[model samples]
Target chain A: MATLAAVIASTHHPFYYKASTAPPEERPPFADEWVAKITAFRETLTRARADVLVMVGSDHFHQLWLDNMPQFLVGKAPFYDANWYNEEREFGLPRMLLRGHEELSSHILRGGLDEGFDLAFSNELRIDHSITCPIITLRPEADLPIVPIYTNIFAPPLPRPARFVELGHAIRRLIDTWPSDLRVAVIGTGHLSLELGGPRQFGPHGPDPEFDRKAVEWIASGDIERALAEVTLDSLWTPGNATHGFMDFMLMMGVAGEGAKADYADSLDLFHTMEAYFTWYPNGVPA
Target chain B: MSKYLLNKFLFTVDRDPDLVERYRSAPHETVAWWESTIANEILNCHGGEASTWLTFDDVEREALAGHDYVKLFELGAHPFLTLTLFIAMFERDYEEPLAFQKEYAARLSHFSLPYPDIAT
Candidate 1:
């Protein structure tokens, strides 16, 4: 059986790559502080010593369109080209090619279908910043083979928060039961309260700081029940138009398990959205 | 309401650098050409399989032609798509980072909770 090395969830802010890498003269004032927090967060994964990563992220209508959108999809290929032209034009993200772990990808796809998820499979997926932001933040080397799982957080008629949680639980179950000697770490990214292309966008803080506060508490404490109780499809709009991305955080909570507190949790309030990072060790802390 | 077509305009143009520039330089002509040529072409499918019923209505066409994001929001076009494409076309005009985005928000400040439905 595979060892679930670490369960990590975070907010994938696209600007982090540019903000952290810009020369001092060109860097934003918040760059140093943001870089420091990300550095410490990166260590959590480093210490886990994961052999492979199961990356969960939402596509921002880059490839998947309303014409054909899937609720949950798994990428089963030997390689995935990351970032899009729009991402480069907007966020200055580097184009990347990530190796795929086809063995585990097949395991999860088969197990997931038997477990009742009509998981969509894509052969050639050009991923956007949702997956790459984490790769940039957590593993700059981008050397590990990954099994990319995309949840439709962008398209409407999206799965409810509860459904996301269920998918997370299923993923955790499948990874734990996979017949393999490799250690796997699962990382997913989401937002707290975001308002993209709306009246409240690019503010000094997230569109709704109050919601961010409670959301961080729910995630860090692994309070799945509380988070699920408060979050609903309709209610998500109140925080910010894009706050539905919070459902991904709920999914990560399900992966971490109910009432299983995080080993490390931290958040930074950036303009437009709150940046959050959390890590959990299911098989105890690695040496 | 052909909200889908409105978003299709934004999505298709946003991805193509040539279309982004074309739309920016000549919104009226670009929207007209797209509606006639590209609007009905089924993405990821062959040209022979193009759909005939995906044309935009007057208001939706005008919104795209005029670059009226305010009207696009009211019509329930996906905000993210609208913003990203708009930023690509207009952000370069601003002196400060996110100035164009902030101005974009200000343009839609009248809208409150329960935003227009973006469901396709």
Candidate 2:
């Protein structure tokens, strides 16, 4: 059976790309610092020798719509051709081919259904910043085969916070049962808070660091009960609508298995949002 | 009206990068195209049980009114679209645009039209 090597949760806001072009002082002080942090993070992945990565992200009305939006969708394509337009492309995002692990993806889809998850499955799905940005930032090489899972965080009728945790646990069960030698890693891409298109979409004021700090502390504490009790939808969006993406973070907690502690956590608060990163080792840190 | 045409408009703009660029570069023209080609078709038919043909011209006129974001939101336009249009149309003066859009969201948050029952 394949081993669950690592579980990482990181922020995926367009501001990372937007800030890359801005003057140094205009961008967050920590923005430039991620190059080093991401490089080190990548080193951990390389050390783990992970072959397949399961990425959990949310769509921004890009590929899905309110007409027929799915609460949870899984990408089952053979490859992902990221379609980046002018502005997104200008942010130094390269158009590249990302490999997709079809067999594992199929297993996950089956497992989700068998486990009674009404998941939306697509064989052809477009990659957006939510899935691409983090990979581009952290795993710049873009070599690993991946399976992308998208949740409906933008539209209404969102799945309960607990539902996301269940999905993660289901994924863990599938990985545990798979009869393969592949070393798999799971990534949850989202953020602390920062509204987009809402009234607070653009601003000079920074994200609520107090909210972010508590989130970090909760995730790092390995106390799922406390995390669940505290990080409700109301509390998550205390900063703004975009903070709802923290459901992705909760999903990662479930993927990290029972007692995953934060191997590392970085809170990078940009001008308008908190682009945070957290890594947890499911099988405990390698001595 | 189904009160979801505005939702469709925002979804279209968000999905199509070229359309977003068009709206950003030429707001009046983009809005005109959407009004004539897109919104007209969607808003013309009464979406309720009764077979009533909506007056598309009146809807278009209301949409064309200058800075009519709040009016549209009140008329069943989704808050996401209204705020997006506000920012896209006037983001050059960033802070003010944010304030304007925020006020619109604040107002809509009180009313229950587009986002009915969707706990935010």
Candidate 3:
């Protein structure tokens, strides 16, 4: 049976790439260090010899927009193209014609549907900063086959964080059902607090470090129920509208299972953005 | 105008290019459409006057940037969507919409810097 080997979640802000190119004097002190940490995380993946990577993040109107936005989507594409570079020059990402795991994605899509998720499956999808930044930061080589799961937390009326937890369990069931001797890693990519536009359009109103610190403590406690009870959706959004990205973190908590410690946590404030990286492992799950 | 009216008008213009083109090419007809389509409905939602002639220049000057856009931001338009609308309009006149959008957003954005770095 396939085994869930690791679960990781982190911020995927475009500013990280911007910070990478900044002059040493102009750049934040921790920018380069955080990049190094992500690289180290990738080394851990390589050491674990993971067979497939399941990437979960939100779409930022790159491909899906107001006309047609689904709350939850799964990639069914056999081959996924990395096209952020074509649309925006700032990314500085090398284009990748990457492969997707059709079998694993199909199973997860079916399982999610059966588990009462109003899931939308797409064979035609575009990879944006949310999905692309992690690979660029952690796995620039883009060697691993990825299964992209999208949550429409970018806009309002997003799925309750509780639903994200349920989706994580559905993914676990999909892994157990697979008979192949595979090592699967689930990755959640997003940010801690972000407010794209509004009254604070140019003012720092997020990356509420206090909220983030408490939230991480909750995750590290390995108490999903407590986290769910305390870190309510309103509380997350109270920090900033962009904090809804925590839905991805909730998914990671669900998959890491009860007693999953946030063995590693790094919170960095880049410019005005609040970003963090975390690695959580299920109790008894191997490297 | 109410928050919903401004957001709904801008949302339609952002999502539909035909409306934008119409607003650009034929102001009176666009104003008519705005009156019948958006202004009438949204003003009814507010129980306010819905008779103003909304013109192309009014959209570009007031709705897009001038007073109404600022008011929309104040009235609680989704910040990300607000930036996206600016990017969409920037794409109309500029060569690099993303660059302009980012620069503009950065200027307006306030940062929460100088946090304690996480120990290795």
Indicate the residue-level lDDT of A27 in model 2: 64
First chain TM-score, candidate 2: 0.90
**Full ranking by DockQ:** 1, 2, 3
Q: For each of the candidates, give the backbone clash count.
A: 0, 1, 11
Stretch of 10 with least lDDT, candidate 3 chain A: A198-207
Candidate with the larger lDDT of 1 and 3: 1
Residue-level lDDT tens digits of model 3 in A1-287: 88776777878877666567668886766777877776776665555567888999887656665535688999999888865532254345556676899988888888888889878988978777788787777677788899999997765657787888888878877787777788888888866666565333333434466777777676666578887887666676566657778778788788777666776666655545666777755434354
| Winner by lDDT | 1
Q: How do the residues A1-287 of candidate 1 rate in per-residue lDDT, one tens digit apiece?
A: 99999999999999999999998899999999999999999999999999999999999989999888899999999999999999999999999999999999999999999999999999899888999999999999999999999998888888999999999999999999999999999999999999999999999999999999999999999999999899999999999999989998998998999998999999998878889999999999888
Taken over the whole model, the C-alpha lDDT of each candidate is 0.94, 0.69, 0.66
Q: Could you give the candidate ranking by TM-score, starting with the highest? A: 1, 2, 3
Better of 2 and 3 by lDDT: 2
lDDT of 2 at A32: 68
Looking at model 3 chain B, which ten-residue stretch has the lowest summed lDDT?
B111-120
lDDT at A191 for candidate 3?
Answer: 64
